[model samples]
Target: MTANANRLEVAGHSVLLTFGPGLETVAEEIDALWYHLRAADDDGATPQIRLDYALPSGDLPAGAVPLPARPEASYTISGHLTREVIRRLIGTRLLLHAGAVAHPELGILVLVGASGAGKSTASSMLGRGGAYLTDELTIITPGTFALTPYPKPVSKHDPELGAKRDLALGGLGLRPAHEAAAPAPAMVLLLERIRDEDEPEEGSSVTRVPLSEALTRIVPQTSSLWALPGGLATLAELLNSVGGALEVRYREAAELEELLRRLPPAEHAETAEIEPRPGDVVTWEDTAPAPGRIAAVPFRQALAMESGLFLLGEHGAIHLPGLAGLVWDLLADAGPLTFDQLEQLVVEEIGEHPESTALVRGTVSDLVAHGWARRG
Candidate 1:
């Protein structure tokens, strides 16, 4: 490979970056973080996210995010690249901004929270004897919602406390976590805090939340849920499979590792199979038999994920999945369309299946009933 080009693969996506000739420091730092998982040697498959990093060159490449001249700028550029890739893949994959570790027998455990909420700290500490899936982004496969591990370099900011350098999985006395060919999450924990200075003697606490509430809380934690096809419905399915969530408010990040041991054993239901396709719509045939004209309800934001859709505004939030997502996209474009327009488009996209029109009609009725959409 030439000095100008580098490749890193994560979560079934490949990122290839071609840098300007003089940018050796930038390339080295980014590569140190991901080169172990490089696709440079893999059979030549097209990359999903390809970027050209130029150093204030006369003209920028067609789709490249321009790089900074400062050597330290490399770190920021790498982060931006990761975010862009995650955003691009949101519709195809269920990507969450979270952390994960695998158990000897129970399978994968997930940690989720807002940035600076100690997700990385907890994930790094939990990696000592467990598999480190990721400390930043966790990607869930469509339909089955199986989590595919993508362990990125762990960032250590508190050098006075520990290793200040950003290091790969093995750098912290842990091996890279093997990606789950068929992941079945054992547990999902939301990392909360009781106090900043709570000591181990103070002890930690775990609280259980209803699946509905857990689903609501987790939706916002996702990196790009707005871009997902049926995002909300997809998340709801995932939470239902897990039963619910356990809120872990602890004194130290290390406490999470032990919490895993004390928690109840993984249940067969936790890994039970779920609907595994993004565009698959729930059957609404009986709920609202009559179809109506469909229109987009203006909102602060509205989007469709792989299997769900949502709209938010000062008034409130309303989300849907199954056929609702398909309906939302159809109306979102040009205000409202007739039933014929929806059926025609649906048929064109998914084929002239008998249930397509009925599904769209049922979905529209639900939207109208909820006042999230209008029908005429």
Candidate 2:
């Protein structure tokens, strides 16, 4: 029961962590980790966490803070200690509460779902033959998905499964999840447990669904979004980037692994090209445009829409087709100019037409509302 210190690198950040005395004694038997993390503010508070060890630790500096003292032993399935560690480690990087696994020949699959959806079981099952990216959370950025493996400890469970897999309970210090860089998830799987009657026979089955529904189910599973500043906007961007949804259901771990191995790798489709000319209709209400077509640009705290030639606002574009072209040109030229600057630019470029000024202001307002551009 000696106290021990360990470090795990997740999402390109190094996290200095420590476990309570003798905590490692029970590590291998279960599927979770227990420890107390020092507060980021150095406020002498401890926040718990169930984290991965494989995440990058380079971002965490050494001796940042000492691990907090452990509480008196009590019977519990799992416990954790965290601070602003996860958010600070990744910054604005795309974070997901999903398990990431990779195979030498089979590629990578991201298992996304709420806790108790079999992510740990599935990851452990797959890691028997392939590489385990992470059993909990993963961070993704443009063109890369980094696995921040939190190596806490595993708990006791089904004897048959544990024995069959040779899983034992004992503290082995933290270990990285993957040896090589993790590729972006070709397929994002939302895992769901099958009811007795609904269980699929011998293989994993995948089905596609709308992106909205997928985001709805997947967002809540993310370990700590609310804790991160401006996390909601970041999450929305991530959902938009993934583009679609998928559901995976299976009965047995082996069956699911086999199914994943047999399936083709998932690919992100290129954004569809938008036609230049406007014809019959021209508003959000007319017909829903595809994502990226008219994204709500966030300016400061307001929202607006950038629709082709016109920067439509809640009111209307200043010059409609003619003036809209000028607005776009201004935005392109100025490069993320603020609303005040944009208004001034409009006056400079098109001169002082009251109706035109009103129109431009309206369009800018709308674009901000939709999150196409920001004030700063």
Candidate 3:
């Protein structure tokens, strides 16, 4: 769709979105939902979306349809349909209801949490000086995160905060005009509202939790988890690709923003040299083989090293830290090396030293056992 077709624009990107009459009542609040994503400029285009309803509209808009009465039925339908559309149009793999904003020259800060977890409030506070990417759902694909701009105007539950930002529904023309989606989400910050502020910040004002812990909260907050085709496997892969996850605890929105600014960028933990411990989940970059090659594995499978070799599930070698060095040496020959050829290269690189050989052998064994390498 062309930019002219949309009415809302933030940071030169469109936040246009459409909802059938079923959602007309809440249409005015959509912009407040996306107030935090005004500064996102990773890409110039906004996400395109079309809402299809399964129910009939009673007093809704002209094209309104009624939604099923089942609990979560609307969310399920919206998420599933949107996911398919995003995948086909933009290659996005995950779509989440979250908040996102960018730091001047640095990367964007994403806020993800359960419904009513203060994502919308926090996003607005952060957008005061920065740009807003989104206040609701964020779509994640490989390498990019597109924010779904709320078609409606900003709505503030806290009248005080709303007044502070000059955000009045009628004043900002906060009405649903068209449905437009932003880029996919880049980072995900799982927010946890804490009653006590006992934990001291780690240098930076924000208290950051481990990636795994963050995922526990993030997974549940997703638009629709059980509906995904592969279930947990698909969820796991998404968490793995996201690389870093954190649980943010803060009461005030401004405090949260300050804390987020102190955090660093998310890096691919798979590339790091940190030794993997039990319960340590890491992301490893691997591509599917040919079309006929065994059906593709979901992304979240844990990393396993059999006898010290690394591999992903029942297929593909894991070229991580220590193993990567060995793989580099093997590829030095520039030939189509079989598993055994690669193993031999490890032996040559580390020599006959028992400890080194054992480590290298274990790593290679793990790779083959996991279906990372096919017998040549």
Q: Candidates' TM-scores?
A: 0.65, 0.48, 0.43
Model 3 accuracy (lDDT, Cα): 0.45
Q: What is the lDDT of residue 96 in candidate 2?
A: 75
Error of 1 at 290 (Å): 24
How badly does each model clash, as a count of residue pairs? 15, 60, 50
For all candidates in order, the CA lDDT equals 0.66, 0.47, 0.45
Worst 10 residues of 1 by lDDT: 267-276
Q: How much is 329 displaced in model 2, in angstroms?
A: 26
Q: State model 1's lDDT.
A: 0.66
lDDT of 3 by residue, 255-292 (tens): 77556656655544332112224542233344433432
Candidate 1 to truth, TM: 0.65
Candidates in order: C-alpha RMSD to true structure: 10.8, 13.5, 11.9
| Runs off by more than 4 Å, candidate 1 | 1-3, 40-46, 57-64, 69-74, 158-165, 180-182, 197-203, 226-229, 264-376
List, residue by residue over 247-351, the lDDT tens digit for candidate 2.
777766667756655443332322222222334222334433343332223111111113223232233222123555466556644555555666787888768
Question: What's the residue-level lDDT of 166 in candidate 1?
Answer: 57
Pick by TM-score: which candidate is best?
1
* Model 1: per-residue Cα lDDT over 1-376, one tens digit each: 1337778776667778777756777777777777566775856887888777776666765565567756445556657666876877766887787888776654677888876578878888776776777887888876887777777777656556442345666677666675544476767888886574555455577766654446557877776664566665566567656756778878678677667666643222122212223443222221322355566565444434443655543344565666676666666654467888877876776677767767877877887787666665
lDDT of 3 at 212: 39
Best-fitting candidate, scored by lDDT:
1
